[model samples]
Target: ASFRGVLTNGGRGGGGGGGALLRRSSSIRELPRRFSRQLSRRRSSLAESLPDTPAGWAASTAVLSSFALGYELRLQRSLTAPPLVFSQSNPRNDALRETLSRRRPGGRKGILTRDIKPSLWVGTRGTLSSAAAYALPHFGRKRRGECELNARLNFREVMTMGRDGASVGIDWEVPPEKYDSSLCRRKTSEERQSEILEGPIRKPVVLILHGINNDASFGYVRSLMRACTDRGWIAAGYNFRGCGGVPLTTPRGYTGSYTGDIRDAVQQICDRTASPSVPVFLVGNSLGANLITKYLGEEGYSGTLPPNVAGGVSLGNPLHIHSGNMSFPWAQVLGLGVRKSLFLTRDKWSQMTCRNFRAAFLKALLVCQTIGSVDDTLAPYLIRNDPVYPFAVTVGYPDAGEQYWDDASSYKYVQHVSVPLLKVTAQDDFLVYGSSLRKMSHCLECPNVTVVKTRCGGHLGWQESPPEEQREGEGRGFGTSSWADAAAADFIEAIIESRRKSDKEEEAIKKAREEEVEAEVAAARRRRKEEEREGGGRGDDDDDDDAGNAHMERRSTSEREGYIAARVAAAAAARREADEIRSRL
Candidate 1:
């Protein structure tokens, strides 16, 4: 039957109503499929008009996003959050600003306040801005090799056994062919022997510590590692117990406050490097930042830390654990991740000697709904009951939860951090309280510590719009998709360069001193020769001349001995003073 006739006359009769209705329903169902097919054809045409290949599409999307992000950033009224007010003059802050400015591509004119220009959308000033940071990757596309979440580089693993037989793994980034070739140099026989006895000249080490429940595999961590290696540095990531796919060697797990393994790993690195000249910069992200700050403060206060630790950079550091208000949702999510880690390693827990403790801990973990609850369950067992370094856990609170948070926090010992420390925090970081940062920064008396507060940069999410050169991977130069990584590399470079320059100046001074000493010795010898020629005359017999020569020789020897002894003593004193100064720096 014709379609129009069927609709109008109901299949030409009153009894055909049910058949017509059935036909109508079937037609209605088919309409959606027909429409979908038409839409697909149109979509295909539109996609062809845009970019056909995946790479081409990605490139186009990136270009469009960059333009959009740039516009948003430019339209913003204020670029940064409110400046942190300090009670005392903070020269370190000024120095840090200058360092960041200088390291920028165009020097001071690149950006205002700092080089880390947070993205306009994700970096908005809000209470949940930090939470937005985790969602940033979905909005913008990271470059192929930069901040790749799934790409795992082949890193050489170094395992260090702690005092308690537990192990911490360090994944070292293998340098490119260029770095290896560049590192090669001719050495003197003595220098070669010294290197053989000690170790090869180590590149300045930049060791990264990941956040809670995170590892070397994290995109951010790997990106930073890549950034370091790009700068010709020895980059490494420190994995906590059972992290980075390493099996848990012991029943014990890691806590924020438990820095014993970190201490051991660093000590091992220092030992392996042999030369104290090889600088080691410890960079910590999130929980790792807190760990580093606490560790540095503790070591700096106690005077047990190594001097080769040149500096520290703490990103998204939770200065005071209790100060920040973590949303229940975030807390629960983090708790779940922790629980998952525990579940994956349930076999290891089963082997634990304390059966009752393991049973209760596992049970508590299964029900943990917040990070606070997780810490409360984990801290006492990991730290207070630690078999290796029980006495090391000193920071405490009356309540178990408070104690875990307080002990883990860097707030207590932050003032004692002696190394040149760059503490970067975002005002909008959800995990960290801005007030705590402000208060801590205000009270900070350590001239070596610098606190940088950005208006945006949610948590560790300092993702900025990549510059044209960087986006194209052309002359990008030692940077990752992350602004924090770039800033850190620049800071480290500035420090290393400054140190080298200072060393060069000192060397010049030493050379000048040596030259002056030689000149004085030469002048003295010349004067002695002149005096001997004048005093020994033509009127003297051979025997008299000989006796006179012998007397003058003895006098010359005595004078030379006096000069040598005085110079040696002076040189020794100078060396002692220099040693003291270097140690302090």
Candidate 2:
């Protein structure tokens, strides 16, 4: 019988007897058909409402799955407890209200502001389940599926020679069409040549560094590049040696602690832009973050930091590599799909092999179940055997203790970083332990470093909100904007703004000092002129006195001569004897 008929009979008089009759008429087989039809109609309506695209379908599936999970969890919770009674004055409700009302402490001053809260979808709950629900769908296959929806990006490959004489590939993303037409594009080869001869345009640049075995072409990295371009920044990504799908010129590959490639890359970028005055920022994900932080600390400590690098933003960077390696097994178990995706870079592994290297390569492929195992197995052959390994050892991991974790850790160098550093990580990041991250709390003592720890962005995944919850200005690009991307962009902008304000203040002070110095010089000139004039008048008076004295001396001399002649005549006889006696005396 139809549900309508059963409900109609159940509502009739005779109470229990009417309900029993209604139940007896309602057959399970009939119910299934009726429900199937109803579900089919609803599905058809949903299909029509959704966009006819893969992203839309994936999004719809994710939304439905999330709702279903939430419903199931709620059902389970309800089954284990008494039925909830809705009330205005429930103490539990009041406590929940209070908890929701309390605001989290925002980012401090400088590069980050705590005021920039995560979207409601992200910040609403801090549970691992909620985090997985949001992260898995958006960051999972959905991101890869939606790659075509992203804004058009122009990429040019530039070959930079690494410190070890290896040719490194840097996929430099040209500015978006809007900025390219206005600020970046050159009209002719002659113009480009002239600009190179003179200097490239002075535009703010953002350098994007991808995760281990990943290149600039990855969807997440592209999203970050898009974010930078959207803000009118010249963004580029440095593909570590063989990771760019290009064969390396040398036998060596990039390592976590080796910063030589990064230094060379930064120099090339600065030189290409011809704008050392323009601010440059580093944005790194996961292993990339480790490398960047290590570089920053080491260079900062050695006082070899490039003058153009203004600040850095690290997302899902495992500071403690040893701990990160230890968690790899767990991450593999929890995110097997993500782990499997890591092996897609067979090109990199293929480049690391030789006649003797095949054994190690096969070993890494077969025995390495986690990223850490791969690192351990491959490092001895691919990295340590390189000719530059000795030099790297001298500069990077000099001690036995440091080499235990492949010297990939960044904790020792954290304190030495002087520039503004924004380190963002999700609480439920499977690869990085909370304890390991907690050890980095000492970095907070350094005023330039800001750590934004969210409850949920998994690993390098900062997924966007579902369609219904998404708000305007909350996200940008192919799908919902990632909170990490937003935070990094905001921090970079803040650093740039701070630098601008600082530059303006310095200019103002310099101008004021110059004006003051000029005023002093002018006053000194005026005083010198007045003194010269007064000295001239005094000289004139002295000349007049000298003339008068000369005239008096002449008159006195004439009178003395006359008196002497008369006296000499009278005393001539007596003077003769006196003169002789005086002469003898």
Candidate 3:
């Protein structure tokens, strides 16, 4: 009945069409025709079912969302998160690759490694992870008190040279058993005190920089110190100006934008150590991470970081301050923290000679609701009026909060960093913006910079779940230590080991070259002696020949030394010239 209806419709359309349809219908008896008709119907059905419009896409998404909860539950049950490592393709990264490989057996661990799984409770949420990792450790009185006591008893405050009229404080952690009375200095008449080391620090010196408004007194800093000490390395926390119980001598206080203090600190550490080969590694946490990144970038761009600096590690750095300040709820929360820190040090503002400045500072503390607002309210006035560190109007020092944030942003300068740097950030770091992180991965053009973006680590919080072996122990639990600490330690240790290996290889090559030169000198002398013996008769000519040959040998040795020296000097000069050109360009 359906075939007769189709034929009637075709016959009504045209005269020959109905005859052609009849012929085709007869051919439908064949297997190929039947199969083709079925295939055409299936494709037509698929084409109708699939989405090709925005509305259709939304409908399809809604259909998927119905079972998303079930999928999420299954995902939670089988969680295996690893960090995403980003680095440029260049020959300079071979050492970094080898370092990573050494840390993990077999080949270098990639983005799929399951070693850095986040705590199940925290999952990959930024706020939860951060709060748990940073706050949970100090919840109990016993734990908190112990950390505070350790900070008080072990860390010795040493003043180092900084900007004019102000000095930077360094809290050096020395165990109670190793404490020497001679190392501690009483208050002297001099405003700035110099740090004197007994001898070169043979092991690596890890200089830790604490976050904003925090100092060596913080529990995390104490933990870091312990970690460094456990590795038999010297640990010191760099207290920003007016931090670490150090009162501000100058009216100006420490700001995150200042790189001068870090440079001065590195210079002092190197000079006091007296050993050029001593390794100094910088590890900055939270705000300190941003500061260290900026400092390293500036130094790397200028080609001025000292030879003693092995590398640097930045933990939970807020790369873009302006963008971060604009983020919801978190920005206001961070601002309140900063305001509280200022409130704690409210007495320091008494030194301001201008009544208006002091009043503005107090007002800003009271009224500012966000970090951006606080900076906008006070930074301009502070920078313009500071006596010790003068910023000329023409020099383009940031006068507005936005300008200051842009200048202070580490991402702006990260591309220029030429040294080995490990940037560890988590997807859950509320202080960092998603856009800023994406920009960071793109901006890191230098091969020396290795970025580790983990699935879940809150700001300065990299707490991992305990392994099976440690889970059963009495003292073992979560929040005991951070994966970041171990990673940073491994990175620094790997660099040190690589450096030692390189030095040994260089020494071996130098020795071989010296031996080759000595052999050549011996052969020349032997040839000359044989020539002297072959020339019979003890005559004046023979004596003159011997004297001339001796003179030639002396001249040859001096010429060789001069040639080598000239080559070295030329190489140095060329390097300086290249640096100047690069800087100018």
Candidate 4:
């Protein structure tokens, strides 16, 4: 029977209701297959309606091929994609698990492990999408929007001399209540040197190094300064030469390879407080972070770092400079979009007055078209055409060969860093490629380095979930309260605390060793005195001599056992301290 006829019969029948219902159900199930066949027939009819000309055939084939290619590409991507473990568990939890597992007894010593779990809101999935959302606010207007909280913080700007005689601006922001009188009272260079010789000051100072073309006025910089101030730290944002809206004194601006300027800036900051031993921690973002890492590695290996530098926190650092430069095409695509948006909104690019600077900018714009073109065109142009202040080739990039790339990369220097270094990076940073970052991750094998890799957070863009008590119509600020900012601060604090614990452990171990040595020396003197007394006897009885030897052997055995026990205890204590430090981080 026809499907519709069976259904009508099922509704009409009362006596054979069960039989009619079964037939109706079977007919309903077959309807989909029948409809599918009809759809196929319709598709065939539609295809037949098209012209039989070569152009029509070519257009149809092209359309199908494009769809097939897209489907294949999508399928390949899905197949190769790494599973998002964050869906089941937080990335922090995974880090914690890994850290704990790695911290077992007999593990490698001197390596500091840190875990940071950024609180992301639900539905914030996909690295690229999250990065785009985070970077959405900074596209237009070079000037960052000033939040009331940031504006309230009192900032004083001071000009310091760079290594090349260029003036560098340092924005000093100290919490009003915790202001140090010594910092306020400017002393002569001689007096400052004298004070440093005495000892480092007691206050904690956080020195911030901004990225290329950025200064203290940048929202992120201000946010970092404010966060430091809130934590009762002396926040000093060091603006690279010619970056703080001021032309360079020597026409030469900062470069990734040059670290002398950073060293000079750090020295100037330390001098301001007249404390060589003050607890100073460096915080650097992007290029600034890369420079800091390079400086730390170089100075650390040379043992020339100022006594006050405790450790550092580097955010969105491109440690592999050559690799990063090689990935310029990806950076240029995102960077150009942002630049274009800014250009359309406000003719910001047109405001350039300096000839050399304009030329550099134009070269950069020209090189943005491709990846290798940056190194071939812009790099060479910058090196050769610095008419005002010639590029100092000997400072950082001394060679034009392969050595130049090696020397410029910070990855090679990571092994030499002596102090704790916390490196924070994101998987989807537009300016930095994941592959380049992976190359740098190898450096994290060092004991003093701790790397925190988040699933999302575009270059220096780490936005967290809004707070529970957020006011109506008030959106989250882009900088001061970002996840990256909080993570940096936490890592710094953890490093400081770990250092203190380590110092205490060392002191205890030292004291134990000293006591053990004194005890051993006393025992040796006693043995010597007993030997002399025994030797003084004219006639030594054989039985007496044998007894004395036995006693001496027993004492020696006891002393050796005691020494081993003490050493074992010390090792256990060290292990415990290491575990505590890892947990805290």
Candidate 5:
């Protein structure tokens, strides 16, 4: 029956008896299928009229949403509204400068995370996706254009490990056997790198690092890239060895603890993408989190950061002390399974993988000297080789235990950090252990760290699709994190404001203290004169005593007030600038 016929009959028919009612119910059941088919046909016609492919339809929708949201946000950010404020004065965009800095910042350590991560667990299931303008994508669409893909790719080595010259590579996908000719440099290295940084195109780049067993073109990578792009960021992920279309440049694939490789990769990408002043944000998830945290901490101590790197975000990191330990065991078991599946035994896997990159990994493993307690049982792949097993056993660690608690620990780095940082994690992540994460996070001393911990949603799973019909245990929520809206973009912008305001507050407090000291001196002089006039000789001594005590208290109070006032002044400045910027816009 026609969809309209069911509709018309359902609306118009009169059921005189129970039999008639039953008939009506049967017809109602069939209406749904007919209605769906009719709706699909209508939608297809509408889609054709709109003039784009299915992918384009999604892209267009995302763009229009971004534009509309951006326009509204810009409107709200009017130049004459509250001035965007910051302590550091940027005359060009003073108003916007203020709007960015006022956000609170702090990060929970990756090590002490179990409890804190729960607050961020967005439920895993909802209308996985729908047709509404701001609707989430169902599983199907997220698989395709999340990441732009060409056949395959690889990169030149940036660093070597273990003095043995074993090459280590860490990326989201498998390294392609042959590096793409298009990606090769015919130009001088400097010119090529410069071109990548100052591109023929201007786009906000999100350099992504992957977790265990993942690659650049995986669904998660694509989703994040799409989400970032949807929110107006140019996102890309690189392949590690043996995971995506790429083959292992070295015989062995990557491990979770590979910090040097990831850092070098970031440095290279920064060379390619970040101009001296272009904002660069580092984003890492899960295993990538451990590597990134260590990288940031190390960079913090080194005191030399690439000026192009603006900030970073670490999500669902394996920060718990137990994480690395667990990973070794887990990978050993997996290696066992994979070896059996691939018909390679422990003895053979060593001789085979040890040839090239395995040494680099083992060298990198030396950096994790704390894991001395890990034991030979976890070294399934290396236990056989006297060469490999002995190295694992003899490796020196920064800490006494083997969990890598101190080397990659973000707690120590917080005090040294000045960069803006965003830390996202799930509390209920059974894998990472919430308690350890919380301990580490609570101890991180950086004022620029913002820890967002959810109560549900295991691991990288978070959804922000209108809340009600969102997915469970998915990162769909963080996907909408683009600068199209104030909140999405503010994390990066806020860090800039933080430094400026800190400087401003310190200045204001200095001024306030000076004024207070001057006032105290004047009052002291006035009281001395009054005492001489009133008490003669007796009033002089008593007055002197009173003056000294009062002066001390006043001076102390002024200093305190000065510090507080400086912060207040910075805040006021920020507000005025933001108001002005908003008003103008």
Candidate 6:
């Protein structure tokens, strides 16, 4: 599915420093740097040429749509914007369009990323924000908002540094168009019996998720997917509703809701696929990781296991639920999905939901503009669509009095978990502060949870590239290590081993109980026989000399037999365990 366009000479694609030169040249060439300075000073309004309304915006989109489209990209009008004299030629306009495009259908933005940030106090037992009186909930703020890492052609993925180990991958998924409940129900029923999912994916699946305003095909995801698939891991991506034309029945667009959809999708994979012993690993970036962390934590020991859901790998799982809501301050940096969960959510609103709900969805879609106040920033969300949950208590069901927050928040369930989780984060990630990422390590007392934070990788952007590439350009400088593959493979392997150990332990316990019961039964039989021999012991006075001697001997023999039985059972148990462990190793 690689596009065949001959790329112009650049350093980005490994033309050495050529890409950097080309980028600089392109920027300079694009509208002249002189114009950049002067143009801002002499601003022009869209109204100068056309009215800022829906019709005008539609006309503008019509013009832009005429241009060629990438395999994963298409031009369209912004639902929140009205018809206006918009042009792709506008620098800021292009950036906005690109952001929207990332959130589009069939490709781009991740649907399962986390949203909403709340901070609970560390030791005193209240939310940190409430104690700090942090109005905006921005704790770990950085300088850079976005990071771009040039992927190595051979690996075809992004690499980022982590705390204990380096992990890497490209994560991508296209949103599906049209999600009719009837269709999902039919599919769900079909899934029950068993159905083969037809697709180009033939390798073992390694699911990947992207972040806010970015689809599965975003740079990091694309690189990781290509990398994993090439290395024999089947790769797949998913999109939120609305963005991929899945169409949300609810008026609200996609927000980072920790639904069990990913778990369902994994189950679907197990039910539908036939790759025996193939490990299905989950990976998420940015907010996607946030959602994943919450999902995994909520899964605890009680979450349903997808047959092949061996393990999970998360990059920058911003566990600071309450604090991650703030856009990174600037330079600071940091760090699955399921299907039954998918039907409950979406990417864009259909303008049919209740006003409050509409505002929530819209807030998710629109990035904050500080030039505009928080009230103004939230205005689009408050008025555009709805969004929510309760504080202190477990999150209730959506559309109900209580949201499922209490049940879904990662912090709430980290201690009750049974699976292995690996997290990679950038130290400078503005979205997820390194301190917070580091603190997660403390919360997860179990050895199963591993949190790795690097000096960089900021906010799932993992901007740091390789040393050579880091020397190339501004955005290219941040060197990111490939932590996804190692973390993923390691986690899955650990799960396989853990499961085997559990099985062995259970078997040993069963054998020991069986031996205990048998020994007890045999002793009872001997005692009964002796009682009959002593005339059912009806004449107790008959237990004189000879009878007392016989009974004492029987008691001694019974103790010895019981000891032997217990020893044999224990020995058998130990042997079985040794065999199991040896085989796994």
The number of the candidate with the highest TM-score is 3
List of clashing residue pairs for candidate 4: 110-447, 111-447, 200-277
| Model 6 TM-score relative to the real fold | 0.42
1-585: candidate 2 lDDT, tens digit per residue: 665555667665435566776677777548889999999999999878978999988998999999977875554333221111111334433332233234322522221222223223333333432233333322322222123423334545656665557666666544423333335543443443334234584668788888765677776676677667656677777687766666655544666667777777777667766556787899888778888887787666545677899999888777876625555356455333223433454545456536546565566566656655555555555343211212243322333323635456776566667687877776667666464466566565555666666555566655544233332333433344565665677667766766776789899998996676556555655555566588873345455445545555665688799999988885785456445533532
lDDT of 5: 0.46
Candidate 6 lDDT, 1-585, residue by residue in tens: 112212345423555465566577777787677787677656654337765799988987877665433311221111111111112244333333333233323332311121111111111112221122111211211123211221211212222212112222332322111234534532232232122253323235667776654456455555455445333355666553333323343332334543434544555556545553455667777656766665555454333445556556677665554422444432122111211122234333434456765554345334333311222222233211111111111222442211322222355444434445666654445555644554574445644555554432334433212222211121211122233332344344345545566679899998996676556655655666577678845533343444545655676689799999999997787567446633532
* Each candidate structure's count of clashing pairs: 1, 2, 0, 3, 97, 118
Tens-place lDDT per residue, model 1, 1-585, is: 565566666656564786668788999999999999999999999977987699998999999999987877774436543334232345545554565554355433322244444445644444433443333222223334444322223444546565667777788764432313435763444443343234564778788998887887676677677777666677888898889888887776777777887887777778867578789899999889888887887677555678778888888887777523567677887788888888877887777687766865786577777777776666546643221213243323346677667566677677667777877776667677453564475326776776666666667776554544342331122232566676677778777866787689899998996676556655655555666679874333454445555656676799799999999997787567446634653
Q: Of the candidates shown, which would achieve the greatest lDDT relative to the real structure? A: 3
Whole-model alpha-carbon lDDT for candidate 6: 0.42
Every candidate's lDDT = 0.66, 0.59, 0.66, 0.57, 0.46, 0.42
| Model 5 per-residue lDDT tens digits across residues 1-585 | 554455546545542354456677989999999999999999999877784578978988998998876864543333111211112233423443334433323321111121211111123221121111123332323332233342222233223443223344333222112235657643444443334444532345566666655555554554554444444455556554344544334443444443545555556556654346455666776666656665665465444566666677676665644434455454454344333322222232345533433443343343232233232223332211111101132233324334334434444344344466556654445556454365554424555565555443345544332322222322434333111112234544444455457669899998997787777767786778786788654565566767767887876898799999999997787567446633532
RMSD of each: 13.4, 25.1, 16.0, 18.8, 20.1, 25.4
TM-scores of the candidates in the order shown? 0.67, 0.61, 0.70, 0.54, 0.45, 0.42
Query: What's model 1's lDDT at 351?
Result: 79
Off by over 4 Å in 4: 1-153, 157-159, 178-201, 271-277, 323-330, 333-375, 378-405, 466-480, 505-585
Q: Give the C-alpha miss distance for residue 12 in model 6, angstroms.
A: 76
* Residue-by-residue lDDT tens digits, candidate 3, 1-585: 766766666666454577677778788668687799899999999999999999999999998986775665555445446677777777556666656644253333522244665555564455766665444423211222234323322445556544454677887754222224646653321211222344444557788998876776675666566666655577888888778878766555667676767777887777666576788899998889888888787776556778888889988887777734557786787679778767766777766788967876887789989877877776665432111122222212446677677667778667667668898887766676464576686457766888888766677766665433331111113434456766787788777877888889999998997677666666666666666678763344555556556756786799799999999997798578557745643
Candidate 6 residues lying further than 4 Å off, grouped into runs, are 1-203, 244-249, 275-278, 323-350, 353-408, 441-443, 461-585
Residue 438, model 2: Cα distance from true site in angstroms? 3.1
Candidate number that wins on TM-score, 5 or 6:
5
After TM-score superposition, the amount by which residue 247's alpha carbon in candidate 3 deviates from its true location, in angstroms, is 2.6
